[model samples]
Target: MSASATTRFGMLHGTALGEGSVSVHQYLGVPFAEPPRRFADPIDWSAPFEGGVRLAMRPGSVCVQPTVTAGDGFQGSEDCLFLNVWAPAPSTVPLPVLFFVHGGDFLSGSGGEYNSSRLAARHRVVVVTTNYRLGALGWARLSEGRANWGLKDQRSALRWVRSNIAAFGGDPRRLCIFGESAGASSVALHLLSPASRGLFGAALMESGSPIATPAGAAEELAADFFRHSGCGEAQRRGGQAVLSCLRAAPIARLWRAASAATAPPPGGGFLDQRTFASVVDGVEVPARPFELVASGALARVALLGGTNTDEGSGFVLPAVKRPLSAAAYTDYISKLTLRLEVPRANLSDVLAVYPPRPAADNANSRGNRAYLYRFDQRARDDTSEPVDWGVTHGSEVPFVFERGSWIDSGNTSFTPAERLLSVAIGGMWAAFASRAQPLPPAAWPAYRNGSEAQLVLSIREDATAPPPFRVEVPPRARECDFWERLQALVRDKEQRVAAS
Candidate 1:
């Protein structure tokens, strides 16, 4: 059956997914911002359409970035600030809205990649996902005023949702901004951003935290981009000439330069020195997000955050390719500590706290009504062979979206217990969005400073049974304490260095 919704700009014709009561109305590739000018902030979409009607059936073009499978190649366009929406059919009352951002290391990914139909239909919530600029186009610090355009694009999308979601039977007042990995980091940044205040009522971040590229590192990345893009002469010319040269360059040339600038160094270290990330721009980002959260400078909103059991596995496994030798592991640790700005004197202490294969931990929020969770579910292949990745980064996304069964084939289909786990996770997320609490007092409790309680989501070996989701204090408490101290030491050193 066909579906349509009248947005502020025009009437949008969409399509329906599934059938009967489980069906959801999906509107795809809706523009939330105008076609962006290179290195400029996103402009909110407000003008009426010429025909007063728009076809939102197909997915929008993703932002320009290197192809995921092969980094050497490029795909997408600069004009890719679009969003998609999924709303339950036959809903009389306005449902809670969940606006999601996709994660791609600030390099790649789009909103179209995630299908939120299961979330919308099963949980009776309105789901929205949107694309932002990526790679150099999104994060390059070419000019002092032009950094973090991708973040601005997200804010613009939130504004769009606030103004128009009621037309689609969504509650703007009950909006929760949620994302995984890079998207999760973006949500954290929004939580810390002054401009983003009141745009969202709650936030959920999975497997990511509030981190920003230092100003010095951002400058180095920009210089590298200029050198690789054949804009070195423009750099000599200085001022707007550099931006002009970059804007005038071919899209392929820019993509290649971005790839080169952000490429991992020879011998492959644990942390790549050259990286593109959101910066602490004075206006938009104001200050370090982690520090703001520590100092209780965050916006007043309900918070739900989590990480997988083996977050570093995804990054480490892809790079190592083989079992690590003692020497190689030590070398990797040294490089990692250096990138983290840990002083050489503290190397031994850092190593003591973070032994190989250590259990991961989550940070506790002080002032907000927060709930934390750790996903301990490992992925299994078609033969039921455990995937070596071990609940690696982004593994929990399918469970949270209730799309585990979509990836199944024959015997590989998600077990009954696994399916139940998906339902439980998705339902918790929706409950948190609809109300501040993720679950009833008996199942999950709100996190407090001293209590530090969190949910551990895992399934038992009995495939036909229900999941065993438990709430308890996270493991590796001492390790978390040591890291907190180390972080403070590093921050103090950085501040002193900056002052000098």
Candidate 2:
């Protein structure tokens, strides 16, 4: 039969085909680019789910998010840029659309992991997820030097949305781009990118903020990553060598090497610091994301961003490493000293305001109606397993997708409370897509800029309440000012050096 005849049933992204679901349709490995490179145009690529395009059944190529460290021994290739889309066939209404970008510190993640069938089936909306080049392959800075391939890949997908989402019954105009961890960071980055300006109508971020990467720091991190990637030695041979070796390296070899050095907790992923992320590329990326948001660079798109209830609780386990201690935690926090400033006196006040409750334990009260949420479904992990992770980094995916059957893939069951929480989250996400605002059993308040003024969303409590952020807001814009003066000083010093 042609591609249109198999409408009796369809499976979810991560599971076997089911019966209860309505008409299910999938479009795998659709190439958004001509040749998947900045200079090279994508070749004759897969057609959008057009007339009887073979439903290979599931997702397409995994995005080429590569990373490697000399101490570890990983290297990535150019074939990493690609995206996947899923939806219900023959749509009745022009469903609201959601575009998801996975998270991995702007270095890794693909759309394959986020199944939108249940979410689409229940909510009646079209959903899409993508895989972009990770690490140096995507985020590398050319000054070291290299162009930013990662951000470029995302732009390619946005352009694809502009051209083709209508075929899938999705309203391209009513677009919402959302993501978790680094994916959320991407949304923040896109907000600041020239190429990404008018692509989507709204955004939702989970467990990430615009504050994570500053201009100078982001560039230095790329340098350090390059040094770790053996790119420094590769550069000694010439920039071409760096690209040559990386291009030739297989994805598995690269990921394995990177993971060996900085693998994530338990069974999930590693935390290697190789592969650069979005830097203050003179053109694509300007200053910090907040600078753009504050300067009104973002398209005033409706935005929803939040963190999981226990944002960092996942890394607590280590079948391969030592458990983090209070001292280690303190040391870790110290290293991120530049992240947030807390006074000694205010420490007590802040703790009192946030307390050590659960996920998103203490969220800011107001800011933009960023729709902050805390995914606090009672934590679960395999106590018997070598890598027992709790309600962790990627633990909430199944729930949000409404894939209840697969939630506890490794015998990890969530409570009724968790399920209820998950359903609520799924509903809110769907509602947000259906309309710019959240679906309400509860009213999601707007975030006002200033002190404890952010809307904190949670599972148990009113999703729209204000807890307090440990860091102070009305945050001294002094950092931006400091950067300004520093730049001026550097310019003057450069003139002196040049004259000499």
Q: Which candidate wins on lDDT? A: 1
Index of the highest-TM-score prediction: 1
Give all candidates' CA lDDT scores. Answer: 0.79, 0.55
lDDT of 2 by residue, 1-500 (tens): 11332211222122233315565565665556655653232332444434533354555656554433334443334564556565666577788888888876665557766667666776677788777776545665545324556666777787777667776678888888887767766776776566677788777777655533445655655445445555557856764775666556655554544443333335543332333566665666665444454455655566666544444545443323666577555544443333344333222122222211111111212123444444434344334445644444655666677555333242326555555655666677867877777744235554433322233333544434322212223122334345445546766786799999
Could you estimate the TM-score for every candidate? Answer: 0.90, 0.70
Shift in Å, residue 184, candidate 2: 0.4
lDDT of 1 by residue, 133-228 (tens): 988899998766569999999999999999999988999999999988889889988887888999999989887777788667888888989999
Query: What does each candidate score in C-alpha RMSD?
Result: 4.2, 8.0
Deviation in Å, model 2, residue 121 alpha carbon: 0.4
